[model samples]
Target chain A: MTILVKIFGDLRKKIEGYNISDALPLNLQIESNGIDTIADILNKFSIEKEETYHLFVNGTYSGYNKKVKDGDRVGLFPKNMSLLYKWYFERNEDE
Target chain B: MAKRILRVDMTKLEANFENFPADFAALGGRALTSTIVAKEVDPLCHPLGASNKLVFAPGLVTGTKAPTSGRISVGGKSPLTGGIKEANAGTTFAQKLGRMRIAAIVVEGKHEEDDYYLLKVTNDGTEFIKANKWSNKGLYDVYKELYKEFGDKVSISGVGIAAEIRGAASGICFNDPEGLPSRYAGRGGLGAVMASKGLKFIVVDETGAPGVEILNEEAFNMGVKKLTNALTSHDVTKPGGALNSYGTCVLVNIINEAGGLPQRNFSSGQDDRSEKVSGEVKAEEIKKRGGVRPHFCSPGCVIQCSEVWTKPGGKDPVGVLEFESVWALGPNCSIYDLDVIGELNRTCNDLGLDTIEAGDLLGVAMEGGLLEFGDGKGALKMLNEIKNKTPTGRILANGTAFTAQAFGVTRVPVVKGQGLPAYDPRAIKGIGVTYATTPQGADHTAGYAIATEIMGVGGTADPKDTNKSDLSRNLQLATAAIDAAGYCLFIAFAILDIPEGLEGVVDTLNGVLGASLTVNDVAGYGQQIIDTERAFNKAAGFTEKDDRLPEFFLKEPLPPHNEVFNVSDEELDKVWGT
Candidate 1:
């Protein structure tokens, strides 16, 4: 099963000519043969599973190691000044 | 001869002028207020009680040749957050007062009766005037009436209807060039405490007064030129034009694009309706209406980031509606109409309230079905109640944390009863640290972690990387120090790119005070200020547990972003690592 990976913001700038609305069309070409676990998904971008990155799967929140299903729109995000969605996980360090 | 502090003992109906404290001479802004409050005011006292005090201290550069330094801070035990809050705003009147050699003014004690009064601080002396004619008025009207009597040139700080009602989200409004009462120490509800003291307004008249004297004119000139040049040359400060136009609202699309924009109250990162409320759209509206953008907050400001927005098609600006307020109220609450948002923003400004906290509560209310999502008119109605003192007004006026508690909503985005700003912890992990760590209670400016990711000002932190804990800590400390100086935080964008920008500010300070304060001194001062606030919070019954975010952050996963609040409390404990 191929999981959908969506890159955005400055990270998106690293790629060429990717529009925001159509991020999935660009993700369909990812081969599912070698990478299957959530850890493998992060490794593609020099990331680690416990690296404090906000993980997103589809339109709902998911847990780490949750099997990435076919066509899962996974968005990787960085921290921001305008923190709008942070209440979903409050167990983190207050700093 | 500098004007002395105007000290008032409201209970005794006595007032007097006191010389500046020897230790406070070198301190200004947060340095002065926090120092004075920590030493003099009892931190453990009830925020609204007589033991609590309000200290108004301008930035060190304020009234001096430094540009955009006319900002002032009002420090006290915040009724909203129940923490030490140092609220800030740009006031031209503040600069005029500072020009008269007044470093700060303190208001203490509770009034004997329910009668409200006004405080007038002029070059001659301080006096308490009868405020019977202006009771129950919003800050805009309050300033208008006072402005007429004060000859329109005086600096004024006052509370609004919400403040008079003693709500926690209440703030204090100061005068701007346009005199709309648009600027505020708009966080943590210090205004309510002032109102509790039976003081509605503080008028400072500096007409025909000499501005603050720079100890060394030559060094000051060099420092000012280099600083202004460094600021103007940076991309964010120079080319972005975001500051001059939409102010911080320009970050809406950028953060949304980064997949970090908290939508519908931490449920998702994208709201879709964000476009209709983007900074570009606001700029277009203001442009079409001949509205002014990038207006200075105070005199001598080189980086004019404040906007003078008019009612869409009108000539006079209704008020300032920034990025934080726009996101907090519009998408967070699922409301989209910019006009209605503007009305809500204006109402908040007049009420001397924190727009961020109020919007978060509105979101919670929407989740609980008290108000429907996307009902812009509904938000307008609820905000209208605040000024009128309805039950709903009382609930919403207290801030997001309290409102969420009252409504039994568990998915609250708050810290110490203060509403979280526009970032979601599940999406942007570093900003989560900032929201968690800031002494100011869930404020972004305390540590704007996004400056690295979205703004590209600092070393790019993978907003997705867990390593941001250390990164966020450094930024938070740096930001705390900057806030202490009362310098505009937007300067971070410039200093992040040009290190000299930071030097210019410090050099200017050294020249003024005849001190050899280095950049390290400034950074250390930030940590010191945080330490002071922590000591205050510790005395006020807060512990390591109060520092944590709301519990819902641990249970709920933000949609489209599967991130959890994974930073361990131990990791947080290590943030202020020695």
Candidate 2:
């Protein structure tokens, strides 16, 4: 089973080919196989291991260490976008 | 060599070319403009009065090999804010003026007549051409006539229908590369002042073959190479080249996801239309229409952010579309159509106004029930009234803050009486600090902490934290330096987050000026510039109390994201003082 790893912003370019490339709607397709964690998935894409690249397990922001399930649609994004955020309410005792 | 200053007393109709003082040699753009405003123009004088002086300045590196230094600063007492305002624009014309060795063009006093005229300049000298007939012509047609009469390479700045009516909302339009009257010195009603000077078009035809000569070619070329290389190799500057490819509209989705996207005139922070309004959409549309061409605004521009755009399947593009314009007309008005957004953009360029301010003003009108939310046609109707100078259009022409006040709308996003940019200050707490504290009200580019949050320009920070004070401080300081150089702020996207990038830029500046300046010198110069602007504001009747986000942003908890701007006023007040 393969999962669709969607990247946004700079992350999309860092992991270039894993996207649907077309002039009409610039998209990318990155193959995911044996990528258990978001970290592993990113490693496969040759993305640097940094907290800047936050993961979204289908519209919900997730940790990099979170387990990636087969067929799970992962939306990768930057951590801080604007000063406004719902992620603050996520109860990050460590942060 | 830099150009000599041309001072024009609108009252006396007298003018002379004077050299810039040695002390003012290091200054450019905001620094130069702000200093002139603070020193010469009375801060307490009425913004539209003869006491207020308009300073047009190109940056320190403008005539040199430094990239993207074609930015021109128009500074004066703002009629809308009643405080000092500096609106920056990018164009080849600014460099042409710089090459002409004009450090600054000061327009002071007012003409006796209500009739408008034109100000034309060439490499030899400047001229005030009489043209009361061109007063009410639409900007595009005016630009076409100017290009036809002068030449294609002529850089022209003129007002449109809005300015002739003395709309406090008008701006000066500049011709982009495609010869469209797209780019503008858009903010704080400077165009109306130009019109008040009995002048309309200010054209610089630098066609006489002698380009600006470098005082030290070796140094200038060295600096240009280092900065250009730094820009090309960086991540954001290369593939995710936001400005070159998508322009500023790239922020639509990212801000939406972060929950800072201002929808329908800041009613909410998130726009569901994010997917549609995102930079990806713009890029694709440009590709489909074959309008995806990019060009630098001036000579030696490394980060080519400014571009001429046309309608898909249409030859004439509305204007140079940016993120601010997209938000101002699109989500701000509940209209998500990019074509309509482009039309509104063209309309603003042709009419000579700022897109963000116009959108905010229209949003105020929408709240007043003059038009429904997302009513594209209705918004056009109001803009048309402004073009034609109808009674109602006069109110909308001034700016969003004014419109909000006139209609008793409570949610007007402004600081120091000027309209806010696309970012909702309340949600973006760091930027809120910027919005409140910057001399220019609610200007996103003033500090632009988003460079870190979105693209990690300098470095990534917790955008959600109200304690991102340090980041805000650094960004504000750095941005001031960047603005002074007259380089597009987008250049930071590549330079920051890269090592030796600062060193490279420093190398170029040293080369251009033949002065051995360091990175610390840049920071110090930036601080001095900020200090000057702050002092100007202080003397101009601003208090520490004026450094504040709108009252509602602090109190109101927005939906979709139940967060308020939690940054304390004390923290904001300490921004520059610290």
Give the TM-score of each candidate. 0.84, 0.88
Off by more than 4 A, model 1: A1-95, B449-465
Report lDDT per candidate: 0.71, 0.71
Candidate 1 C-alpha lDDT tens digits along B411-443: 888887788887777666666777777777887
lDDT of 1 at B93: 60
Which 10-residue span in candidate 2 chain B carries the lowest summed lDDT? B449-458
Poorest lDDT segment (10 consecutive residues) of candidate 1 chain B = B449-458
Each model's TM-score for chain A is 0.56, 0.66
Q: How much is A7 displaced in model 2, in angstroms?
A: 4.4
Per-residue lDDT of B1-578 in model 2, one digit per residue for the tens?
Answer: 44468888778777777877888877778888888988898888877667778888887777656766678888887877777778888887778777777778898888887766677776666677777767676788878887888888788878887777767778877777667788788888888777766768778877573555456777677667766776776644553455556666656775665566788777788755666777767776776776744655565666565555677685776656788888888898999888888888888888887787898898889997888999999998889988888888888888887788788898888888778887776555667777788787777777841234433234345544545555666677777777777777766644655545666666666655667887667656767777878887888788878888777887887655667888786788667663
In order, what DockQ does each candidate have?
A: 0.06, 0.15
